[model samples]
Target: MAQRGGPAPFPDNPFQDPAAVQPRPGPELDAYNPFESSAPPYQVPSAAPPPLPAAGMPPPQAAAQPPRKASPTEPRNYGSYGTQVPGREKAARPPQGGPRRRREPQGLAFPPQASAAAATAELLKRQEELNRKAEELDRRERELQNAALGGTATRLNNWPPLPSFCPVKPCFYQDIPVEIPADFQKTVSTMYYLWMASTIALFLNFLSSLAWFCVEPSSGSGFGLSILWALLYTPCSFVCWYRPMYKAFRSDSSFNFFVFFFVFFAQNVMYVLQAIGIPNWGFSGWILSLIALRKNTAVAVMMILVSLCFTAVAVLGIIMLKRIHSLYRRTGASFQKAQEEFAAGVFSNQAVRTAAANAAAGAATNAFRAP
Candidate 1:
């Protein structure tokens, strides 16, 4: 071989061993060898390894490597991967257009309808409870009512009886004390009857006058005078006698009775004037008397007669009422005296009666002992 332009070649030695043909220790020995040196030592290029396997596939050019051991902090993923447990597989879903499946709750579940039914049942139960309470209350009320209506004989017997206080004083009636005197009723009746009779008589008298007027219109102021008389008598009768008599009979007041008598008498005078056809007198009577007479001729006349009769009745009624009132006044005073005596702790008739009964009982006991 031809030598290259470089350091001189070493001499071949027959005595040297083949292994000993290596370079000796020197700076020249540390120099780079041509066969070993393709490039600068500091600047050599390295060949890259083959690409990794695609997901779910084997590597294209290299044999698969043993999987690296997982660090404690690293999670292991396995399946196509090696030597590691696989993550939970997602449940495989059916493709679209497949029949839908119902999903059930993993835990206890209540349907809306079931919940509503439960609420409704609870409400019904509550209503039933309330109804039961109401029924119990009603039963109690009825029981109380029955008790009050004398469920026990003793209770019935002990209850206070109703008081009777009618002026009629019917037989078999309970006697409740009244403010009016006992005689008031009788007096009022008597006076009322008398006044009634008087009123009838007065009415007849007025009618007679009307008849007289019909027979001789010229003798009086004609229909006008008759009408006037009717007007006067009618209202006067009511004002003087009827109304007052009613009051007297109803109330038995002496003052009312007195007033009734006074007004009735005055009315009588007016009626008399109307009957006689006294021009100025009848007019004045009509004007002065507080009679509410109607304007119609026939009605007025009738009313007048009726009023007159009522007036007479009222007068009699007044008298009776006065008597009644007087009796009542005396009775009231006596009652007041009795009340005062009772309040003062004085022995009343009732107390005396009681004392007498007690004394008689004592005496009887003494007599029996002596025997």
Candidate 2:
């Protein structure tokens, strides 16, 4: 009989019986288990043994090798690469894109924990050999300032390196051997001599430029500018970079160090530009000399000589710049200390205070007048 509206009409097999089919998997015959990774290696049965040793024919029996007993091994498993096995001691390897190791750090400043005793000690100990400065902090700066001025040391002006018969008096007293420390005297003296050479180079530049003017009337502008440059650069270079360097080394003044480094870098850059010799710039550079050589040989000779001097000056400037930078890194000069020194100096100066007062008052008055 067919049932309606229940599941659906089903055909039943006459030979099949639900009661006879046993579903239990006990210790008798095992079912196929795909997850049994611990299963032993599959072994194929041996072929029926070589027909009983071939009926005793003096056979190749002497060449037969003794069979080796195979070591028991669990079956190889798939889907387990880059993962920890049951007995592994090492961790899983990192991915191919992992961060590289043993990379060196560059220019990471690990500032000392004990750089300053107090905020006021910023300039003193933040520089070189700070461990010794723990004692005598108060009297040190006063003595330095006094020594800088002629209050403590009787430093007479002996600059210009001229004789008594000459009318032009010696300007500033510069005794590098006497004043500068033993460690730094050589460097400072070298710089002083370099400066003198630079002065000579500038003068030659002016003379060669004058000769250029005499040869070609069109170059009168360059000659005029050259004279101006010589006069301006000579004294200004001395005052700007050289004096600042002198003061920095003499008093261990960080502010002066900052000034020296800044001005001297620009000074070296100017040396390079002068050596390049752009037209109408009043320098005996390569371009100007080569151009003059085609017109007048005598004047070109002078210009070429001056250009060589400028080149030498530029090269020396680069060497000295590197040397100075190395000293700056190794000595008691830091940007933080320089800032502190500058702040301390500004606050102490009476003129700066007066200027500040005037500026503030003017600002206030202007603001009051604004609608």
Candidate 3:
């Protein structure tokens, strides 16, 4: 016989042979080829039967229970827009009771309905209580302030503090109220308007000068000089002359008056010169007009117009000066007062020591000229 690879075939009945008494495939092994071998068939263990319960003992309940439904008034653990979160439950609701009395808002009191006299008496009683409370508060505030201030209410020792904006003591601008009278405030306001108008006039004069420059290139220097004058004179006149005049009128100070007079006289002289239109002064619009008339009529007309404007301004200023003179009388400024003020200023001035040097120089010049 030929040799084979698998185990030799045996009897199908395991009980027939002592070796075959072990578990076998039985008749099912016939379906499989005798030469082929595979892993042993899976064996399932038999399940044991459950035990019966003892008498009178019940079955145990499950660990997890279903969620209970919430009452209508109970607060829910809602997320966004009434969506409930998983595993989170609503809070337990309070037990329902009898109908609730409507509560009024806090701090609002309702008086009882009584006779008119009784109501009036109640109102008066409340008012008196409020007054007593106010008095108590006021007393406490006073006590606190007194404690902070070391007993005295008046600022006897402490110097009056300078204004927040001012970094130094004795700021004249801060002292404006004390120096300038309330009645003179209106006058100062008027003066401010006048000052603003003069500044505007200067600008207009510059524009006119520019127009002249457009007509003649020779007039360009004059226009440039006019511009320079406007820039310089605007701030100078406001600060130096106008302010000094205002101070003079505010207080009858002789030094301030003399300062104002000298500066104002010079200013008036310049205004008159501007109106006259003198040659080579950079403001000779009238002279320019007369000369240009022979050449260009348009240029001449423009110059004449500008010149007339200056003349009008000068005349108006003269009139305003006259008005200011009348107002100055009301300021109580007199020759005697001015003399006293001048003396006081001379004594106090830092420049008084330098005066002797100037006087000696002047004397030397005079002595040289005399020979």
Q: Write down the worst ten-residue block by lDDT for model 1.
A: 170-179
lDDT of 3 by residue, 1-371 (tens): 43598665665675788665656658876686754435343457579855667889986555794555554445877564346566675874556885666888997765555466798999999999999999977765775576466774332221235565766553234233333667767666666666676677677667766766776777777788878878988878777777887777665566676676677778777777876766446674577668768877876776687678677767766776777678777767687887888788786787885886789899999999995
What C-alpha lDDT does candidate 2 achieve relative to the native structure? 0.80
Model 3 alpha-carbon drift over 4 Å, by segment: 1-179, 284-305, 330-332, 349-371
Clashing pairs in model 3?
A: none
Clashes of each: 9, 2, 0
Candidate 3 backbone overlaps, count: 0
Go through the candidates in order and give each one's C-alpha lDDT.
Answer: 0.51, 0.80, 0.68
In what order do the candidates fall by lDDT, top score first?
2, 3, 1
The window of 10 residues in a row where model 3 has the poorest summed lDDT is: 152-161
Candidate 2 residue 287 C-alpha distance from true site, Å = 1.0
Q: Of the candidates shown, which would achieve the greatest lDDT relative to the real structure? A: 2
Order the numbered candidates by TM-score, best leading.
Answer: 2, 3, 1
Better of 1 and 2 by TM-score: 2
Total clashes for model 1: 9
Task: Supply candidate 3's per-residue lDDT for 358.
Answer: 88
